[model samples]
Target: MTPAVAGASVQPDGALHAYARARLADGDGALGLAVASYRAALVQDPARVEIARRSYVQGLESGDRALALQSAALLDQVGMLPRDGTLLMIGEALTRKDWAGAETLVGRMVEEGNFAFIAPIVRSWIAIGEGRYAPPVIDSKDRFASLGLRYADEHIAFQALARRDLAAATPAIRRALAVRSSDGAALRLAFAGQLAAQGAKAEALMLLPVGSAGFASARVAIGKGKGLKAAGAAVTPAQGYARLLSRLAVDVGSDKAGGTLALRLARMATFADPAGAEPHILAARLLTLQGYAPGAITEAGKVPARSWYAPIAQAELIDALAAAGDEPAALMLARAQAAELGAEPERQVRLGRLLAEAKDFAGAAAAFRAAQAAYAPDQLPWTLLLFEGSALEQAKQWDEARAVLQRAAAMAPNEPLILNYLGYAQIERRENVEAALELLKKASALKPQDASITDSLGWAQFVTGNVEAAVPVLERAAAGAPTDITINEHLGDALWTAGRRYEARYAWAAASIYAEGDVAARLAAKSKEGLKPEYAAP
Candidate 1:
């Protein structure tokens, strides 16, 4: 359109100079200008959902359903929004009786792990709706233990009543009671309007504890809902109370319990309000920490595109996918946000790394090219150049790789990682071995803890014909990185060349398991012969 003309368009200010000036046709409400301006900005960058978010919120407050829907779609497209929107969106979907849409929204969030905390509650509703009278979550206890509140408590109560096991329901009801202690009220509420919905009367008669107005409010809301609408409205205020109970449970639960609780809460948030990004983020992070890659991705998927948390959630998702060896999928997700994301160079670098990890060298090369283009005017540009060199070297483009690496080394001479790798490469090619040894020495001093650098330094010592000196250093490097195939093989080789035959055999034997390339095979064959034992530990 024109430019972002806010409410004060009389003269012309910051926004009017932007594309939103055309949207001024919406008239002069506080939200009108912002909506117009943001939409205008979106026209310039269709993938720019954050700007559309401003329009969406303003549209919602202005009661412009169409505009709100548009923005909401944008949020979905961009993948980040408040969790509160979960309740609002699903509630509206239910109001229109759009079962498919509701299912898609709710199910997507659950699958994405956004509603981890409230998952049990949502599952309870779904099960109940499907006529499963007593559907208690096996995971509920652990989750509730963390949040200090168990949605399963309600389910267990209902299940006990279904089985006529009032006694079994006692413990669960008791737990809910600890949330505020109202005896049979929580039990009764759990049994509302279903087949064998016991405890309903008891719940109606239940009152909140003497103190805690918020708790009382929530207790009443839960007691009042007969169907889903009332339940939906009831959830907003109740969540705060539940969250407070959750905080109480934070220390009360173990890490496993907390993880369970986080998952349930995320599910509940998604089922009830699909728009909340934090719950999804929380779920994704928890799952990631727990080493559940698929679960983490599912949780991250709950975020709306318009959220401020979108980038963080995306970054986490990408990391998880990469760690899980699903680099291709990770690249797809990250690339979509490349231009708009804050750490443009970082994201590009990450993408390049992922591509390399996947063995898609050409794709990695392309990624480095794009990343190089997006590099910020800072240290990152230099960093990207290093990454480009690495990628090129991996693809065996030695000439290009060498040129770039030389440039990188000169630009940031202090970076030990690059220096060690480049210097080691030069030694391997037998080109500039002396210079390579010098660089490797510096690298060793810089990162004494780095096994690779130590190995490189030791390798250089051996190459320079200092066999006796290489023995101890190579051995040390091998021990430090026991699992490293290269270090083991090198140590074994150094031992043999130094006439430490027996130790060489043992070293080579160990190396066989962890080593790669032709050396490992060669060592394996030699170790089979039971070479003489002249080697000492020195």
Candidate 2:
């Protein structure tokens, strides 16, 4: 009912429509709705500098400083904002108490200055909360000290709160408020200890949420649920916080470290805010821990239920399951997420692999075929053939496996994994011992310290009637992998063939302990029967 509305009605549908809605929502004090609409508007007019700037401001008005900062970053990504704008956006986001928008921002700001000013101050408050000294960094480290502006005292107080230095934060707050009696900046300021992260269900709190809903009830139990519960009703931001952290970890290439951290955070985030992506992210992590393949593919099973990230998570989770020998589970998830995941090249490759892993060779081939037809530069088809061959071989369909593998080898001649697997399979089947030996030798050269490769080399040598040479190679192979029954057995056989019956008996005896299943049991029984001495020892 304002001029902006009148102008919007006649304006062609685009960014302004969304902005109008945001303005309406803002007037109503529907902070969450206003934030959403403004963002939607900004997305449509990404190139409009004023719109981009206003988008961030609107976010702040809704008490979602994180989202506001993120809008600034999006503009930065499009080269719309100046460096100072980026710095300012980051600064504003970090100084806030409510992190409802944290799922969108924070990291961009942290990188601007390594949080030299903010981190220490927050740490100071955290220390005070637990009865400790404000760190040297708080007293002298923050770069803000260099700025020496009127807000220096307040900056220190904020940093202390960020660090959970409640006592230090309290004094700084007093000094700051005294200096600036009516600053609107402190509208939603929550106490330091009251807003610290509380494990899975209770992530780092906003410490300031006078505007919208907080995840006070919905909580997760990342790894330390009891500790989280102990801090109940206090901290607990939006559910997306855990997923945001998880995504950031992948972005920064710190997966192993990130994975551990994500799992803990996700448990809390998912529990605290199940409506968000936290659950899906957590599910993805759980699947990874449960022996699924690594990366995006093995993360579906651990996803919190009903999350939008479910399809993405499923794609990753299925691949992991397939790689790890959980074929059935992989197939089920792949089928479920196929429509949503098929568009992604990596997901397509994973889908193909899952089909093959499940011995649905036809399905695997079709997936690969589709990926190939799509002309995907990543080349899912080549890997699909390898998987198809493996599935066929597993089913004792030798000819089919051989055909598919040969094509795969032709397509990917230099790939070590494919060459090694094919050569090893041929060796086991007694089809091409010489070729298999050559292939395995190449693999050994590529990986000299690999015990399995060394063992294969020794086996090949023994089969080729080079017993004298096989003995030392097998001995080294055994040394590299002392617990390998195959290596020990090969050494024993090589020794036996090389006229060292006594040594051969000792080697076989050693092998018996490491052996298992039918072959091991048979070998153990045979060794127990005592071999006839090749000619009675003198």
Candidate 3:
């Protein structure tokens, strides 16, 4: 493809050179350098709309607030500023406590009708900052009506707390929490911090859930009478509004509607409140999902180590580094985090999951074992045992894997997954065929809709010399999960055993579609030669 800036051949200038450099850096994934070059280009040719637009987006992606604001100003001057750009302008006014300027921008937002839902909220904050205590009125018909109302009330609560009006703040916070869908833990923690800061330590302590590792630092601080020093507490209208924007970002992200708008809101939130951790974490997650791993790492690395979200940010950073093709750095960071938070089983499990994703099965098994050791032998959870057994199995430690799986099965007798795993492993190892068949039968019964479990039961039937029954069961399994290579292969074996030679070849052909390596070779052989003599007659 020809470069858009290939116009460097036509009356070249410094701006053209810088624009070409920026485009190259952008294609090379050096987003920070791209933003810098774009900024330089814009500085050289302030009238270049193309340069301004490119710099505006790259600035947001690279977390360059100055560049974003500079480009945003140029765009606004030409009446080409996007809604989010206008938002950035409003946020800047709010940050500097320029109430009149913010009100003017809010008027612009209202006239544009692009961000109408949030315009009222921003205007309410501007009013509050200007000493007007009018309540926020949300239109019940707005698309984000619930969220708008919830966040407005939350801001009011924060504003009340700042005024030491606990009588009003408490109920507003309670109303916000009631409307919140996903546990509202962050709100509880932040509100608790504000309460502690207001000398209501007992009330603050009551807001936190007992025995949560993330709240340990906050709890200790409040206990020591030092007040909660966390960064997320909203002590002012602007910070409260930032928190609300961060929540809206998460809402948009959850819809899987693409990350561009979510990242915009997240970047705006981070700019509006530099000390807040949630916005940084949200921005990092969105960037990572969009395959901008370097940008993700930068966002995650912004969270202060003393904040409540530091551990979450560390995990995000490790994952981002791994995604960026720096596995060694990811491993080093994961190992350091696991060691530091070794007492927390959750962190160890996260490390184990990361190792598993990296295909370091033995390391994953070892991490899972560390997680197991965190619990008493008698108190071990079946889920942990299952994870350890699966990792060990993948690591080729079959003997230990079987033992751990057996323990898991005994602990969770009704769990279809545990039953299916143990039964399937026993069948593969050709040990205790009768017991394996019974286990598979129960698993198939427990989860009739599960194609894999049904496939295991049918395979067990074929191994037990029930060819007639196996053929139909395997057919059902194959029909349920038509794309499943293993199920189709198992169906082929059953059909071949039952003398349906032509249909068996068709089944093998279906299984061969996505097969790879040895499986592909074996499927090709099966389609041509049927089964081996001993297996041909079941």
User: In model 2, which regions exceed 4 Å deviation?
Assistant: 1-244, 251-262, 265-274, 290-307, 315-330, 338-382, 501-516, 529-538
Write down the RMSD of all candidates, one decimal each. 22.2, 24.5, 5.6
List where candidate 3 sits over 4 angstroms from the true fold: 1-17, 44-48, 77-79, 110-114, 141-144, 174-188, 227-234, 332-345, 358-389, 397-538
Candidate 3 overall Cα lDDT vs. reference?
0.82
Among the numbered candidates, top TM-score falls to: 3
lDDT of 2: 0.54
TM-score of each: 0.48, 0.47, 0.74
How high is the CA lDDT of each candidate model?
0.59, 0.54, 0.82
lDDT of 1 by residue, 1-538 (tens): 3132334344343433333453443343334455566555555544545456665555543334455566667777656755544544654554454545655666765655545555555444444444455353445355434441444465454455445565775666566556544223322332332221343434433433322221333344445543323322222322322332233223223366566444433433343344544445555655566555665777677665543245666877887787667867788877765545233555666777777887877667777777666445464556677778888888988888889899888888988988997898888787898999999999989999888899999998887888898889999898898877778767877888888888887777777786666665566666775433322111
Question: Whose TM-score is higher: candidate 2's or candidate 3's?
Answer: 3
Q: List the candidate 1 regions with Cα displacement exceeding 4 Å.
A: 1-275, 305-312, 322-328, 339-343, 376-378, 516-519, 528-538
User: How well is each residue in 431-476 modelled by candidate 2, as lDDT tens digits?
Assistant: 7888988888887788778887787877777777777777788888
For candidate 3, write residues 371-444 as lDDT tens digits: 88767888988988889899988888999999999999999999999999999888877789899999999999
